[model samples]
Target: MRVTTTHQLYTARLPNGGAAVMDVRSGRGQWQHLNSTAALLWNQVIEGADLSKAANRLTATLAAQGAEEAVVRADLAALVSHLRALGLLAASPAPAPDPAPMHVREVLPAHTRLSLPDRAAGLLALATALFLLRCTPIRAAIAAARLVARLPLRPAAPERADQLFAAVRRVRSAWPGRAACLEESLACSFAAALRGRAVTWVIGARTAPAGAHAWNETHGNQVIGQDPEDRIWPYAPALRVRHGRNK
Candidate 1:
């Protein structure tokens, strides 16, 4: 026979004063609110007790104070139903066992340089597209855009990184060209590169004497080469990740 053990739950402080309890067995997607009484019961349940034992303990305490056991039982039953719906509880033939804690590194992927247009214009266009996508308020749209932005540009695939790079370089080198033309070309290039990936490009000054630099990042979280936090910017918001070398 298979024996089940009660899974351990963890709590976190929400932005508000209330606490949020997450069921480890169900992943971060499963969360619930915990009041003082409910918290006490949850703790008891984690200590190798069954849900029925926890409910009885609560009922007993309430009954000792001249409370109605029937009402308490009803309330506990309702609470259990809600928790089960939220994936915080599970029933099996044997006592449930606690799951081993997962490490952040185990879940996160290793960093690498994405294949992108060799030309600067293509990268700029991709960045602009990402910025526009992030501006939208709809969560699903925003999430989809972000995912696309994070995808690394693969020159080996359908896109030619060299041609794109040359185009961008020409535009950037032509210092006296019309500003509008330059901006439009750059935007198009950036948008193309970022079509389905989650990535952010940083365009700004690195230091007082070194002049400006442009780079890209994944998830706007990790940069490829430079130390993201150490870099300083004089213009535009410092995009999410710090400046760094592409890995």
Candidate 2:
């Protein structure tokens, strides 16, 4: 029963000898304060102490501070339960296993013929997406791109998943140097949506060095523009960008 803080949360100790916690994800600057006992418990749990270890430590500390032994034990128990309910405690997630031999070479787009209009729009979108990702914060860039992608556009009839993938890869080739996997994936997704095809944006992770990666998957779970090595990244996604229809 080790404890851990949730995402986008900030914790700090105050001059008044208490702890303050704020939730960044809510976009509301609300804060919660913890008293001495709660703060101590929070620290112990955060430092990787198990439930039994934390409770025993707190019990001894409070008892020596002139608190009654029975009362200290009961109060600690109640505090642990309360914090757990508030999502401040949980079992640790299992780790990713060692990766097998993987071959992750970059794929070049097919030299498929395209109409002038389709080629122009995809290239333009690719340029805009690349600039945005390089210059702006990632969350804001994704939000802005998604908004544009969802806008109404009378594009050519929906293309098959593989054809759409090839078209996307072609647009991606114009991007200078090596772009982040996120940039490539989102650009492809945005372009596909413009062409009236739906592709899912996937974010995955690798554990040993703790890196995050991104790519696209079709509705049928086929990956676009990414190799099988990418498919076996081993860690779960930290984020996913879904289109309006999926929402």
Candidate 3:
């Protein structure tokens, strides 16, 4: 008799307190909301309990609430379908064998180098801009300036035009070199600053007349540069609005 082994599955926790399980090989996915009933079923399944026994227990508990036997059976069938689709359960030609343990590894190499100073300064500037942009009653631009002043290290003083140009240039240079990670890090920094503020943060990209570019806008509807409309989303829209100007 030929024997087949059921492949192990993986699970990920979602931001909304839900859980998703998937088969690495089959690419099937299933999601379960962490409600009281789901929590009870999950505990039973995880404790090496038999599937039919678990279903019976679930049916008995819900039956007390006037749930019909057919409804309980349907729920159990649906749960089984979800688990099978996610590769959590499988019927081998023979009886099922114990699943192997799993392990996870880091995506990026430990040796990857990052410029902490540049990244930190960029984050600080992003935070200051978001705070000023989102606050009610619209505090003076000095509030923004003061926030920037509190950063550990400051970019060199420059003319207003120069400062804007530098920020644009830095982002442009970083994009090609670090790819998605760099973009994601910058977006995260920008998002962190905007948290709890009324402003919205959108990260978008578009092909510009010059090249593909990304930029932000604020509530004032001001485009920050000559190419502000280059089809990109900025870190903070409110801050972008205040700073953006049409060429």
Candidate 4:
């Protein structure tokens, strides 16, 4: 089997010299923590190394610490099996796309509201996002939103984008379950897309705290739903789903 990763995976280097991997294929988002040994193997796989190549590199590294080549190879093979079973390792050499580069500016002002129709659309979008997140993977959910947004509608104005963001927040306020940044950001972006507004949904990771977050931003480079007191600025985006000109 090839040591390829799926597009649904998000990885980050920890501040304390470890690695974090998240599988968002399921909407719930499963996590797998990697130790130093596992991280070495993961790095090799991510860099497009074949099984034998990864084994050679791992054996050499382990040898420096006086480990036997046979033992190291066995351990590597076992670890690869575990990872493959977890759906982290693709069976073929299909390369996944790189993470979107991070480029963000000041936060958008929170002073906007939607009209009656827009409010209805926004509410429906939030409801759809909530329901889909419970059943489908994040990738499918985002794709659904993109499909809906493909209608020949005009691009949303800056104020409209702000209004949709607020609308999503308002709708989420009434939800019984506590919605984190991931759900909130995805819902907001979906709502904007429903109105033919193309925004970017960003997944960012913070090194110091060793955590991840999600948020939305407009094409003008203004971050949506960002607050001065929140931890938004501390997290660097690890992945982004771009719709328009947002860089």
User: Each prediction's Cα RMSD?
Assistant: 16.4, 12.8, 19.9, 5.7
Q: How much lDDT does each candidate structure score?
A: 0.40, 0.55, 0.35, 0.65
RMSD of 2: 12.8
Winner by TM-score between candidate 4 and candidate 2:
4
Q: Which regions of candidate 1 deviate over 4 angstroms? A: 1-8, 12-19, 24-30, 91-247
* TM, every model: 0.31, 0.49, 0.32, 0.68
lDDT of 2 by residue, 133-221 (tens): 76664544545545644555333222444454455567677656665566667766666666665556655544343445666655434
**lDDT tens string, model 4, 1-247?**
1122235676665444455676766656666667768877776776687867887877998898899888888888898889989988863211222433444443344455457766776688778877777777776665554454444445555566667777877777778887777777788777776776776676656554556777776655556666567664445444556663212
After TM-score superposition, the amount by which residue 69's alpha carbon in candidate 4 deviates from its true location, in angstroms, is 8.2
Whichever of 1 and 4 has more TM-score, that candidate is 4
Quote the positional error of residue 236 for candidate 1 in Å. 36
Better of 2 and 3 by lDDT: 2
Which scores better on TM-score, 2 or 3?
2
Q: Whose lDDT is greatest here?
A: 4
Better of 1 and 3 by lDDT: 1
Model 2 ranges off by over 4 Å? 1-109, 148-159, 228-232, 245-247
